[model samples]
Target: MEPRLDLLSTRAGGDLFTMLVSANNALAASPLPRATQELVKIRASQINGCGFCVDMHTKEAAHAGESPVRLNLIAAWREATVFTGAERAALELVEQGTRLADAAGGVTDEAWADAAEHYDEEQLAALVCQIALINAFNRLSVIVKRPAGSYRPGRYA
Candidate 1:
């Protein structure tokens, strides 16, 4: 399938892409565990219905040694046995954050408290940034109808 627009080809898109890449790099260098980052990225992508992102993050996670079992279970994380309490908390945050419109009050205090229990202030900051960044990327890709299955890990590195 062809994309509706080539985001990278336009000047405005090039600027936006640079900023997004910088944000992503900041999150990547944060205190949050790489595994948790991948899981969060995949989960947010899944929730946003961005196939391009889902494909990209899943492949990146696998390349970084994430097991197929865990990758496959992200969509059903609430019922899965393979995740840590911290990972589960992050996933919950991602869901609430991504689907903010569905919940009247946005992310609940309970969810924030749970995440606070698992992560320090700095890590929590990074986690929030990561979730927001992925959601933005998902919207961009989904809106553009970007095709999936061509991403290679480290392509932009």
Candidate 2:
């Protein structure tokens, strides 16, 4: 299916997306592990129901050597035995951060504390930024009705 609007074709969208992509690339250089970054992006995209992002990140993660088992278990991460405690903490943070409207207060203290246990200040900052950036990308794609299933690894790069 064709997109309602081609985000890349417009001048404003091109500039905005360039900045967003740059920010995401910078976050990738953070101390947070690459696997953790992919998980965060996938989880946030899943929560936002952004098919384009789900396709993009899942493929990218796989291309980067993420095992299918862990990728498949991301939605059930809490009960999965494959993930480390730190990965679990990051997943929890992504969940709460993405579903902020469902919670009475934004990102509960418990989640933040749990994340703190796994990540240092700088890593936590990176995590938070990744969460926000992925959510932003998800919204933009979902709203624009970007079709899924055609993304190639490093297509954007």
lDDT of each: 0.94, 0.94
Give TM per candidate: 0.98, 0.98
Q: Looking at candidate 1, what is the lDDT of residue 116?
A: 99
Note the residue pairs that clash in candidate 1: none
lDDT at position 95, candidate 1: 96
Candidate 2 least-lDDT 10 residues: 1-10
Please report the TM-score between candidate 2 and the true structure: 0.98
Q: Tens digits of per-residue lDDT for model 2 on 30-142?
A: 99999999999999999999999999999999999999999999988988999999999999999999999998998999999999999999999999999999999999999
lDDT at residue 7 of model 1 (Cα atoms): 92
Give the alpha carbon lDDT tens digit for every residue of 36-84 in model 1: 9999999999888999999999999999999999999999999999999
